[model samples]
Target: MRRGASRDKPGARVVQPPVVYVHGLGSASTVYHAHVAADPRLATRRQLFVDLPGHGISDRPSGFRYTLEDHADALAAALDAAGAVGADIAGHSMGGAVAIVLAARRPDLVSRLVLTEANLDPNPVPKAGSSGIASYNEDAFVRGGSFAAVLERVDPLWAATMRLADPLALHRTAVGLVRGTRPTMRHLLMSLPIDRTYLVGDVDNDLPGRAELAASGVRVEVVPNAGHNIMFDNPQAFINAVAGEAPRVTADAYKS
Candidate 1:
């Protein structure tokens, strides 16, 4: 389910497109949005939280694929249902990949993108979350204790929401993340004409093809004293990135 407050800010209601937060695998959008939404430094624009199907409080359809593309489509539908267009989007982890697909597939709904520690490559290492879950077959993952084990080991911050995810949805989503898209999220990201920024944590700072991304106009910024989960580690910095504060989008004379 989506939750948000309408724009009736101080003075007149200058209704700008809302800022939508999309969560990663086995997590809720509120995990990040809840922490930063009330920050005074944040945008006056309404903040919308999208809890993807099979995760958080949303219903899990047994037949759903829960793939990146599928998640992206769901996001688009959610935004459309909420009457939001050209929104500022901040997506983390698997949600970031989903966001990329959203922007590529439905460019009309996204104007600015801030991707935090997003998964750009396909079939990621089988050590971390997605690949780890993908390693298990659906039956083994859902019926077995693997889901419980994951909840036991994941970061406490994430575990809170991960525990709420449907085992089958989580497993299928993980498998889809590993399979990836035809052009790949990275390829689509580079070609996108919208404002794009990839926020990386200082700890996991080594992002492959950094130079190429910069050349292609994707600003790669770092949040200090944080890990893959920047929102949980340093939310202020994440808020800065989301509110378009830290990097400082300078206003200059038109180049065109």
Candidate 2:
């Protein structure tokens, strides 16, 4: 749990609430280590890294639905386990979406939010013969060998994790991601009472909606020379962005 600057030091500044880092699909808490370790601001603040249910070392309950809200609920429980009242949250991709839902559904558990390339639309692009999650072929994906290839290139550790993850849990979560719930990502981002920031990689061409988000008054930051996986491509830049030290840019350039 709690790690950062010692509170016993004389004249210690007021302690900032913990910052919880949530990883995206097929990713583990280790993805945030580089950025967290290098960020000086986090040295004095509590940092919590969550391994969402069905991913990493977390348990994979057979009855779980793995919906965005489900993931949020699990995260809320994790916070309770940590004895944290509320925390600043930084989430990437699927994790970002989960954070949005958490901030909307359980405002008491979130103080601030940092969403990096979170899915904003309820309907995701078609994949594997379906425009939504309804048609996802989990067994085929796992058995076809494509998932393995993708994981191997992205991160061998992730590949290993995938091999062990509950197939149903992973499939259901993926489906839930594509078929977002009633309070969609867009609504959650716009309505949450807490402070919200959106960060994207310069090369994340898939995120064409950042401009719209910026127009809505949300602060947006871009990590240069990076892609969808900002932390993996430019960990230092991600840390800088999270620390509010990264240079700001108008979202006009990212408009579709």
Candidate 3:
């Protein structure tokens, strides 16, 4: 299992057979920290909350192309960096898309896979109002141009989204989204193959597949009372669905 920054923090315990969590677009690993922290069942599992390159404290190299494959490679590198050859994997939104790619490309590294609010459509679903733009873009464009111009464009939208997201995470996400460039995200989105078995928020504006995913042998669980940010709005529902579907092996393997 891989270790994360949480381990070195005060009162942190060693994560066994770690669980790597990939955050959604414009967000950092911290997005799932509280939700994961609240769950005792996942305590023993190490948490590798990736900040992805160019987000959070990680390096923001010039000419970085943010794509699904790039994000997956970042995850793979993170695992290798942590010496976690085998671990459980989970992601949200764009991160979810990346997680699916990672599992598909390197099945051996992933013991289990859980994706929340995964936008597998390969095309952006229209969202209304600021919450839509703020939730998705508006920040990345401005900041990604250059570090000096980054926050100049990021501040206003970041503040606005914070107000709408009663819980504060929406605001945090806005900031994270501003950190990366759109070309990278779009490139990654375009590169996605639209395949995998995972869960998506039933309330999510995008993804339109419950029947197809199930019929295709991909387990799809719908988290109710939640939108794209299921981990924040409906943690229990997300947890239950994940617990039910995300196991190291198939159901038959666990039955006996």
The most accurate candidate by TM-score is 1
Instruction: State the C-alpha lDDT per candidate.
Output: 0.81, 0.69, 0.52
Model 1 lDDT, residue 166, Cα:
88
lDDT, candidate 3, at 253: 22
Ranking by TM-score: 1, 2, 3
- lDDT string, candidate 1, 1-256, tens digits: 2221222122124566678888888888876667787777654668788888888888788888887888888888888877789988999988899999999999999999999989998988777699888988788889988888888888797788888888998899999999989799999999999989888888968677776777778877767899988987898888888888767322231121
Report the C-alpha lDDT of model 3 over 49-78, residue by residue, as the tens digit: 776654544555444445455656767777
Number of the top candidate by lDDT? 1
Candidate 2 per-residue lDDT, tens place, 97-132, comes to: 888898887888888887777777766766421133
- Lowest summed lDDT across 10 adjacent residues in model 1 is found at 3-12
For all predictions, the C-alpha RMSD in Å is 4.8, 5.2, 8.7
Candidate 2 TM-score, true structure as reference: 0.81
Better model by TM-score: candidate 1 vs candidate 2: 1
Clash number for every model? 0, 3, 6
